[model samples]
Target: RDRIKTSINISGVLFHFVDTAGIRETNDAIEKIGIERSKQEISNADIVLQILDVTSLNDEDHKKLDDLLHTIKKEDVPVIRVFNKSDLLDSSQHSISIVSRETVISTSAVTGAGLQELKNALIKLSGVTDNYSVYSARERHLNLLKAASLHLNQASDFIKSNNPQLELFAEELRESSDNLGEIIGKTTSDDLLGKIFSGFCIGK
Candidate 1:
């Protein structure tokens, strides 16, 4: 229920939000799977939105939040503490301070309140610029490029050696080419075969 029904677009940056099942000790088989998935998402998340029931806040919940915060801190992820059901809270119960460093927002899902503030907080925390580009580069692309660079560096070292091992040098060059090819959605063997069938020299 915590998940947003749709993706939010702010200043041309698209934000995809995922709602996770409450993480707690449960013996239910399906619940355990969901908890595991939630943990996985937390580890990979750029930002985490932790929703809390304003009316049911208790000591046990605070202790759990602290533990979760500790784990999140180790990964250097930012978390926003959202107190839901604000419409039900009495005036005197409004001044609860859970975490000093985190961004806290009082929200009423039924009244459509505090939604704008949440969106604004997300935009600020994401560091989205007015001219943000919609480039398609992902983590895998950078990893592939890094691998290619490493192979090329090895090939360079072979070249600089007093007695260069031509076979090893060629192997490194091939590996580099393979890595580079993967970035462009090609495979080294496929590219080589194509060239060979097209009347081009294998060495070329």
Candidate 2:
């Protein structure tokens, strides 16, 4: 974390590291819980870092990668594919396509090789500005989106009917709007706030 003290400009932007963790695989129940927690963190993050051992992106690893990618996709998260240990690989044997549209950065983290390029890539991905404003949402927001979409379908069906119930359509629209308001915390309850903040660490 001390390495984060350096002052640097990236396309006229400043950057800093907030948190880091080392993932270890094990069959123990506690270890499994850690894995699940890591997965949750990735899902909730705006960007994900997927580190791959450059020298061993073989069949089994590829299959595991496929599964991991599927999970990330399902969570609608963007990933930066880091091909680590690049210095260990022979220059001529360095051709691999891990994920489509993913920004790939080959680096020897040991020697700080290609670190500058990696930092630039990350800054570009993080589209923050002096007047940056983010609209945050939760799982309830997604559920509301789904409900609104369903009501939209219902509205479409009503538009096709010979004699549509305008009252029904209006009620559906109101319910959808309420769901959305709850999602954005405009109409949310204290219970939801508790659930959300409880998931984070005490200091956060």
Candidate 3:
């Protein structure tokens, strides 16, 4: 987790630190390794917080956003899209637009603006909204869960009548089970394992 981590204790609630390297295009071999490590962290993260520098967004930033988001989307995890340095955003900044489906928050870390709202968004998306276990599950687990959920919902709609599409229902169950198996290394590929674990402890 490098020096980018710290405890944020607010109103008796303390959260563990999970930080990753900033993703960007780089030519240095050492930086490339760091980027791979960051990708690993992102794949295993609970919820991703993508912070965009409102004042510095350019064409290159827009291109990079698509690549970074592709990694997150593969896991089907919730994302908190934050626009940082809102204090520096001029009123004319509205002319520049970013298209995102996730919840967006304008934040000024220096002024503590939108800090509470950001935390609230985190708590809600992390499922602290419910009394569910907050175990840090992997990307495969989430992907499988989402697949299972989608199929299950579809199956329910088709099973309303006495004569249901048993074949389709069974197929969905199999798909969900197969996805779950991948999470436990049973059906996972060696390539996936290599990608997840081939990282050095840079600042541990």
Candidate 4:
């Protein structure tokens, strides 16, 4: 369980969080393999959360974080610097000097401090917009909007042609309108309406 990964979904986004053993001098062969595997995972990670123990602050800790940062390019992936075990240390000592105070998040696993802020940070790191439904729509609703946009683009092309296909343009406009209507619960099909309502868990 120590080297395994745990996946959790937030607002339709899946996050694979890995728990790796501390990077320390180990002569044990099995531990060495696990450490290498952990490195591989870090290399492939979309976002990294480096948790620093406040009480165990030392030059070695800083060096390890620096090495890790070098491995993961900051321009490609954002790194979240978390100072953990804040409850065990003073407020003054809870800060990380290398990173700006605004970028660093102070958290206490035992006391659940700064957890909500951490969640918001995780959602942001996952590349999701501010909220799941910015317009009070679900993931399906967003897909419909995308479809509608595509149809409108096709309609525009039809209208711009030298010998404009007025019929095709009208058809594309109709499809775009239908997709938008579906997003707003104006679907014509009873089966689609049933599926949409059931997805919201209205009666089931």
Candidate 5:
């Protein structure tokens, strides 16, 4: 399939981009493949960009729009609805009702209109705030958390028993504290530290 190529790079993270063929009414194999691939991509994506044609978001495209929303919502991924080709709409004469309370940006891809606003909207939707400090969290930390959670559950069960073992509960509490400490680098292993620092840029 000779489809258009699209790529996106965020800071230093590279992501694969998939561009699907435009929706068509025909029952051709190519169109079917395109639809299937598009669905797959939407399901796997961390975020869904539901692009709407600003000039055609009426009854004609309502069913398709509803279907797209339904498909994306199945995976519980956050969606940023884009009203593209907004320049074609007469803002002074006509008004479109956006169902969502969140700001829906009007974009004209051809003229770079609203691109910055779109980017900002996407960044905000991603839930990464500027005030947050970046830190590397490894699988080890997740494992420790899981283990601690399990121990805590066990401790709770023991406390509910008629003959509770106080020493065992105390040991479990200590283990949970140790696990939490590792997450904040208070009790991290040398190997973990080496792996984390090795992945960092040389200048850092």
Candidate 6:
């Protein structure tokens, strides 16, 4: 009951994958925590892959899948239903009835069948092109951007006020600059400090 993260580059676009714990009834505290994290990851995902056992799907599974589909739809994330262990099924059982609008793929880990189809489907849905460049980011980057935005907003408010505190305004600007600098590895503090000192006219 844990998450295993890895990345793959397909068609020049990098995709981050987080394989989470399988959802099931559990009374164990650690397992419950893992299940909650899985739900959170699903909500935050750009695209989701729901794995199902091809050999054991039943009416109860279908009902649970329907509920999961409804929840995922609310997040507006596209999902791919992967029926794994296809090798266990007979050739006549390869075909499955359509359950939803989401793309469905049957794959066999043993014989490595349908893996290519899955990759092609991912490439298509991701809108990757020959000219595409891979760029990957994480949650920390998003949080930094949000912090920079807030500092900038505060600086803007200071500028629009009647009795604008120029010093406070400058401090907000510096704070915003520092936040952005964390992302790009450069800061304007030295330049800004020089400008502030030049304005002081200490010799006069």
Model 6 stretches with alpha carbons more than 4 Å out:
69-75, 129-204
- The per-model lDDT (C-alpha) reads 0.73, 0.61, 0.64, 0.70, 0.63, 0.77
Give the least accurate 10-residue stretch of model 3, judged by summed lDDT. Answer: 195-204
- Candidate 1: minimum summed lDDT over ten consecutive residues — where? 195-204
Best by TM-score: 6
> Which one is best on lDDT?
6
- Of 2 and 3, the candidate ahead on lDDT is 3
Q: Which stretches of candidate 4 lie over 4 Å from their true place?
A: 69-75, 91-96, 100-102, 131-204
Compute each candidate's TM-score over C-alphas: 0.57, 0.48, 0.53, 0.56, 0.53, 0.60
Residue pairs clashing, model 4:
none
For each predicted model, how many residue pairs clash, with residues at least 3 apart or on different chains?
A: 0, 0, 0, 0, 0, 0
Report the lDDT of model 2 for residue 76.
54
Please, what are the lDDT tens digits per residue for candidate 3 over residues 124-170?
76555344434324455577778867866876765565766655655
Candidate 6 global lDDT: 0.77
Q: What lDDT would candidate 1 get against the real structure?
A: 0.73
What C-alpha lDDT does candidate 3 achieve relative to the native structure? 0.64
Which tens-of-lDDT digit does each residue in 15-94 have in candidate 6?
A: 77999987777899999999888888887788888888999876665555456657766436677889999999888999
Which pairs of residues have clashing backbones in candidate 1? none
What lDDT score goes with residue 161 in model 6? Answer: 99
> Which scores greater on TM-score, model 1 or model 3?
1
lDDT of 2 by residue, 47-103 (tens): 666777888765564455446547666445556778889889777866666556667
Runs off by more than 4 Å, candidate 5? 1-5, 10-16, 22-25, 59-65, 68-75, 101-103, 133-204
Instruction: Please list the residue runs of candidate 3 whose C-alpha ends up more than 4 Å from where it truly belongs after superposition.
Output: 1-3, 7-14, 59-75, 94-96, 130-204
Number of backbone clashes in candidate 2: 0
